[model samples]
Target chain A: MAVATQDSAVRTGRATRFVLYTVLLVFALFYLLPLFIMLVNSVKPLGEITGGSMIALPQTWTFEPWAKAWSEAQVGVEATGLRPYFWNSIRMVVPAVLISTILGALNGYVLTKWTFRGATVLFGLMLFSCFIPFQIVLIPMARVLGEIGLAGTTTGLVLVHVVYGIGFSTLYFRNYYAAFPTELVRAAQIDGAGFFQIFWRIMLPSSGPIIVVCVIWQFTNIWNDFLFGASFASGSAAPMTVALNNLVQSSTGVKEYNVHFAGAIMAALPTLLVYIVAGRYFVRGLMAGSVKG
Target chain B: MGFLDINNATKSYGSVQVLHEVDIEVEEGEFLVLVGPSGCGKSTLLNMIAGLEEISSGEIAIKGQVMNGVHPSKRNIAMVFQSYALYPNMTVGKNITFGLEMHGVEKSTRDAALGDVAKLLQIEQLLDRKPGQLSGGQRQRVAMGRALVRDPDVFLFDEPLSNLDAKLRVDMRTEIKKLHQKLGTTIVYVTHDQIEALTLSTRIAVMNGGYVQQLGTPKEIYDTPSNLFVASFMGSPSMNLIPVTVRVEGNAVYADTTTGDGSPAALAFAAPSEVLKSYDGKTITLGIRPEAITDPEGADRNSTHIQSVETMVEVTEPAGSDTFVTCTLGGQECIARMRADADVQPGQKMPFTINMEKAVPFDPETENRIA
Candidate 1:
């Protein structure tokens, strides 16, 4: 009787696991369905994309759309493709992410360790800046960029992204650094280290997980930002997101669905590749940043 | 000038003062432990000494130099933090040598210093491991090693062993005492554990409410605390304080109290001291250690001053070597330490001897020791 009961329990457990797996699989497919459709439609020629079912695999897969999307797709009056704008985005993002993350780390260190009498209030005000919508800053940012003689340039876009992205980067680093032990800093000071020496040798070395978190966060935000890119930049300085919009919305020629999808995929590939490469660190970073120790 | 002198050191955050004007002087090789309960500003005082926190007012001098605004590193002191504060990223070797490296010591000198510290701490094998990979005791040793490598003018420990388990704490306490003996370095240690203060300190400063309540040798602090707070705070099982009415009969002084069963009792002792002589017929707080009041058989029978009193035992707690027996004196709970093998039982009226020679009285109004 005991053996029979154990066998029945095993069967019930297997049934429950099966139901759980099936539900998870459905959710996974439901989330991935759009990407699947985009991939399937991206490889097909224009005629096949228009005529065939969207869910089906392409009847004859070709790289023409990808090639055209990279080099010859018309965006505005020119057909110079996404290559230049992709480079423009890269130039803007690298410096923006680097500068903002460095500034955030410094700000976080000061706010936590060398805090003066109103430091907490200052931090609270800085944190409040993270919630302000991008639309609210566009006009003021444009004027600032113009006054600085960086208007409609990649440098202007980089400056704008760094200015707006610093709030989030600072928030990430401050939370992580606040959890970091202050005793290490004191020990370093007692060891005859000056301010920058302690930061370089003690604080920055222990800041790996938070750095990964801030860099990835800033990269994704700046790379995918269309609002700031469109408002502050145009022509040769337009970013990938702005160029992709122009490509997809151009009305002079017949609609090219495959090229549009390919352009969208191209614009998203860097961020997706970033996630694929460092996705493990992303979760670990978030967890470490949240925990005090 | 003393080796390290803190003259009227004060600390405040905004308008609220946390540490009042405090003064302490240490000789060249004294292990001074600052002991107090939590929120007593012991840590704040230590930080002030380390130059981590600004002195709100007054002066701190080391080796006859005023250190009010000197940077911590320039103060020529090293601190071992309560958390052991080992650099998480650096290996033990790196952590120990970081100070030397920051001061621009050459590679060879730094290596020699590191080797000496590692050997001294018996942590040579663990030097290559990061702090995260070390056990609690190992981290503590590395913290000490880091401070030791510097050979600073003074060493500061801020409750360094409080994180260890009970057995490890005792072991580390012995190791620290040994380290101090071998190095003969002037040290200022802070802890809330009275046992640590008693065992390791050459002198102790008992702090309460931001004031240094008393400062003296451990034995002096233990045997002749200056005030009621020192008397109660410095001992385990704590000194039992009972309100007793003082009476004088010729040359003898007696404390009148009640037994556990509410029967009247009086304990006769040597004549009251001049300070307490005026308190005749007035109630005062009588302080006696637990061991001083014990079962008759467990007490020093050869002493001429031992006085016996009958009381009902309310509870018996056998703690290995000694059993702590609780009873009532003047309607207040008091504990007596007896030998573990003593024949005592709860709810029984037993004759317990009180070592009247060791008893001290405090003024009820001022809570200050009278005799």
Candidate 2:
């Protein structure tokens, strides 16, 4: 009787599954409708996008707006477009993500494995950093950036994102490294491996899934960050999000919705690509310590 | 001086002392096991020897050299952890050779050591597989192989066989004993299993609540425990401690106690000690192992001092190899080991033999054995 109930539970009824799939598909379409509209409108001419229904297929598809958004749109008093800011975001996000992830991993290692007095309190404080609103840190961060002589520079933006991203990445790696067997660390220690040697050879080698999680999280967050970009580094060093915002807001003549749509897609492309490549690992990393070894 | 000496060692976190002043000198090639219940500081002692934990107040010396502040690696010790602790990312071969690599041994030398250990452990075929892919026993072997390849001054094992299933645990226990025999390296092993401690160690340090309760050979600890704790902890169907009053009548020593029916009974002692005379008319705890008290037919032929007691068998457990007969002595139920076919039944009168030569008396106040 238990087996029969289990079998029925495992194999849902046809009507139930049909309803489940229907609900799932509806939710999927609901979430994806904006992206569908953006993609549909980005390829159309300015006239068709401004005058026609957004969900409608373009009567005449063109890549001119994409080219304009990529290189020639007026962004922040200049028609230099988002190309420079795309590279700027790259320069900022890459270092920011790498530094934050590595530091987070090190912090996690020390916090979990090389624990001392008040380590839990330290971890609690770091976790508290994750909850602080980005707006609250704006003035203090800008002042720190200014004091460091990095204000209005891509390096300044990188520093800003690194500071912001460490909390989350550390959180990810800490929980992951917490589940990591301290026995292995002790074994390595007895084997004559020093602190950095164990971290590099033993801990880091097995930190694949969580590293992916941290990197993806940091990348998407730093890449899509407009608030920090607008606050500290607002000039030629603006990131993709900031530049895209400018390209839409700094329009003087006609409201180029197609160009704006193109710029938004360009701004979103990296994180989307990141997810496409590492989405499964993200889920797996999130669920790492939920189950047993 | 012995090979490894833990002198006046104690561990405390702030105010609470976990391990009291412990002193144990392990001779070269001695297999010393620290056995105790959980939270008994056996593992803490092992870790201190491994240099994984600090010896809070005292010193540890290895080969006449002080190893208190020395790093675990510098101390020349290898440890097998309970979880096996094999580097999950490394293959078994790499896992075995990681220590050598860390110590800057040449690749050829490391490989040679790894090969010898793998061959010795009969895990040569499984060297390329990761620890995750290995069975619990195989992982245990690889863990040992890692320790063995290092050829340290001593090997430390922290409950190494605790993770395996019962059958595998027994097999691995024998394997570890065999390994110890093959390589006469000094070892300090920690386990809560009394049987493992008995079978594996040349000398067993039975610890309780951080103090070394008794330190002796398996025979000494089993046959003649120093205290009630050691007496009760070291044996299976742990030594039945019966409350009896010592009644000295001239030279003959007798334990004046009640039978199963609450009637007065006197069980005589084979050899009376001066301490037994001192405990005259005073209550004492009598310690007797289950096997020592058996049916008359199954009693040890070598033991000449077998005292017979006719008692009501309150319970009889027929455990395939031997029947465990529970009988009340001095108002407390004591279990006796009998032959599988022994004709004993619950609530029936049966003649149970107590080997007085094997019985020990403990001071009721001190809980220490009365020599």
Candidate 3:
């Protein structure tokens, strides 16, 4: 009787696991279906993309669309491709991410360790900035950029990204540093470390996971931003997102569906690469608050 | 002036005063332990001394130099935090040497100091490991090492061993005592554990309600607590306080009390002090340590001050070295520590000897010690 019960229990366990895997597989496909279609269409020729089934593989695989998207795609009046806009993005993103992350680290250190009266209120105000829609700030930002003599340049876009991105970067760093023991800072002070020294030697080194989080967040936000890029930047200084939009939306050409998909994939590649390389740290950063030092 | 002097130090946060005027003077190489319950402002006082918290009033001096408004790093005092705040990213070696490096000590000199501290802490083998990789005790050692490497004029410890387990806490307490002895540095330590204060301090300041109730040597604090609170708080199982009326008959003074079963008993004083004479015909609280009231075999038989009284035991707690017997006296639960070998049982009346010589009397009105 015990053997029979054990056999039935094993059978039930197997059935439950089978159902669980089946459900997981269905959800996996649901999320991956779009990416799979984009990848399939990205490799296919323009004729096949418009003529053949979207799910089927290309009859003759070609890198022409990717090459065209990189070099010869007409974004505006000229066929300057995504290469220049891509470089423009790189110039804006690298500095913006670094500057914003650094400022966030300093803000977090001050808010958590060197706090004074009304520090919480100040932090609350900064956190409120993160929730404000960028569309509302566009006119003021444009005037400010113009007044600051940074308009129509990559510098203007970089400044916008850094300013808008500081809120979130500060929030991430502040919460991370809040979980850190204040004793370490106090100990460092007693050990004769001044403000910047403690930050450079002690706090900054321990900020690995959070730095990755801030960098990835600011990089992705600034990289994929179109509204600010389109409104602020002119012809030559436009970011990749703006150029990609112009390329896809241009009415002068033959639509070029495959080229549009390839351009979309190109714009997404850097952020995807960031995630793939430092994805482990992303999870670690999220779990940092829950698992204290 | 002593090595470290805090005169009339008071701390306030806006309008709320957390610590009242507190005066403490520590001689060179003295280990002063500030002990109190939570919210007693012990930690607040320690932070003020560390210069981490601003002092609202009063002046702090180290080696006769005023330290008010001085930066903590400029104060030349090292502190071991309760959390053992070793930098999580740095190795134990780097954590120990960071202070020296920050002060711009030559790399060779920093290495020498690091080596000495690592050897002293017995963490030489573990220097390469990060704080996250260490055990609680190891982290504690590293924290002490960090403070010790600086060789500062004064050492401040803020409940440094509170995080360890019972056995480890005891072991670390002894190690801290030995460290103080070997280094002979003026140290100010804070803790809420009275036992730790008793075992480690050269002098202890018992705090309550932001006031230093008593500050004296451990023996003085334990044997003659200044008030009812100190007497009750400074001992394990606590000193039992029984309300009694002081009676004077001719040349002798005696306290009128009741046994466990509510039977009236008269406990005659032996060589009563002058303070007790004024309290004649007045009600007072008699404070007695648990060991002072014990089984017949455990009592000092030759002492004239020892008197026997029959009391009914309500319960018995057998701790390995001794048995704590609880009974009612003067309508209050009183515990007596007896030898483990003593044949005692619950719900039975036993003749327990009371050491009246060691007992103290507190005025019922003021709760201050009468004698």
Candidate 4:
């Protein structure tokens, strides 16, 4: 009787495992289906892509469109081309991420650990700014940037990204700071660490999860910023996203689909790299501030 | 000279007052424990002394120097947090020497201090390990070492042992008392544990509702609490407070009450009736600690204001050293502590003696001591 029961239990366990695997496989396919189609279409010739099944493998793969998208597009003349646009995006996005993250960390530190008059009200105002539509302030912000001669420059784009980025960054940091046990800050205070000292020596090192959140959020927002890049830059100062659009537009003139595909891939590579490297931090930030009052 | 003096200190958050006008004075090399329940402002008062929290009004001076606006580091005081907030990024040795390094102490001097404190805390072997790799007890020791290495004017602890397990808490309590004896630094400790307050403090300030209810030696706080809160809060299993009406018969004072097993017992006091004459026919609360109520055989007859009562032992807990017999008296549950070997069982009728000689009377309406 015991042997029969053990066999039944093993069968049940196998059935459960089979069902879990089937569900996971179905979910993975649901997300991968689009990417698979895109990859095959991007490699296929126009005839093969138009005359075959959308799910069919490409009959012939070619790198001609990628090459055409690069040289003939002359994307660098407008901004930095694909190469300089990549560098420009890095230039604009990196500093935007760093400055916003630092400001967010300091704001979160003070808001969470220190008590001052009207701090909550000021935080409330910052929070309210997050919900305001970006379109509402576009004209006024453009005028302000133009008046300062930053309207068409990479520096102006970075400044704009940081100003807009502070709202969400502050939110991320404040929530992250809330989960951090306040006793640690208090202990540092008692150890004689002043404001910046504690922030630099103590809080910053322990801020792995929040820094990931800030980097991922700011990089994705600033790097993929088509609206700001296009609106602010009319000359050789556009970010890679704007330059990628111009590449696609000019690619049709030369019939260069492969270079457009490569440039599209290039435009996305930095954010993809950021996500891959800091994916753990993104998940940790979600879990770190789970317990709050 | 007194090492720490808090003169008329007051604190509040917005309009919600946490601590009222308060005053305390500690002599040099005194171990004072401030104990109260959560939200009683014990931690807040400790923070005020540590300069972690601002005092809304009043002066705090350490070593005869005014410390009102002086930063915590400049105040030259060290504090051990309840959470054992060892910097997670640093090794144990680094954590211990962080304060010294901040103050620009010579590296050789800092190393020597670290060596001495590590050996003192018996954490010499664990010096290189990060705080995350250590157990809770080890992390606590590192926190203490961090504060101890500072060798400041005073050491403030905010419920430092509350995070440890029961056995470790007892061991750490003794270790702290020993450390105090050896260092002889003025220490102000805060805890909600009465036993910790009793064993570790030279003087204890039992606080309630932001007020220091009583500041006295442990025995005084235990035996003669200033009011009902202190009387009820000081002892474990707490003092039993039964409402009773005072009656006088033939120049004798008697408190009439029904025993546990449906029997009447009148407990009498031998003191002069005049001491309680004004309370005749008035309702009052009587406070009696569990240990004060003993078995009849072990009772101190001369000193005992004995009340023989017939009470059914509803529950008997034998905790090795003592047997706790909980019985119902006058419809109120009362616990009595007696010898463990005493033949007592649940659902058995036992004759217990009430030691009323040290019983205190409290005003029922005001919750204050009547005498």
In model 3, what is the error at residue B368, expressed in angstroms? 0.3
User: How far off is residue B208 in model 3, in Å?
Assistant: 0.5
Q: Write the per-residue lDDT of candidate 4 for residues B1-371, one digit (tens) a residue.
A: 46799898989889988998788999989999999999999999999998888899988999899898888888888999999989888899999998998888999999999999999999999999999899988998999999999998899999999999999999999999999999898899999999999999999999989899998999889987889999878888899887777888878888777777667777786463475768888877878788877778867668846777777888888899999889887668888888888888899887888877777777888888766
DockQ for every prediction shown: 0.85, 0.90, 0.82, 0.62
What lDDT score is found at residue B289 in candidate 3? Answer: 96
- Judged by lDDT against the true structure, how good is candidate 3? 0.91
Clashes of 4: 7
Residue B314 of model 4, lDDT score: 87
Q: Number of clashing residue pairs in every model?
A: 0, 0, 0, 7
Question: Which candidate would rank higher by DockQ, 2 or 3?
Answer: 2
Regions of model 1 farther than 4 Å from truth: A1-27, A76-78
Point out the higher-scoring one by DockQ: 2 or 4.
Answer: 2
- Candidates 1 and 3: which is better by DockQ? 1
Docking class of 1: high
- Write out the backbone clash pairs for model 2: none
| Candidate achieving higher TM-score, 2 or 4 | 2
Instruction: Name model 3 segments beyond 4 Å from true.
Output: A1-27, A50-54, A291-293
In the range B181-276, model 1's lDDT, one tens digit per residue, is 999999999999999999999999999999999999998898778889999999999999999998987778889999888899998865467667
Pairs with steric clashes in candidate 1: none
lDDT of each: 0.90, 0.92, 0.91, 0.84
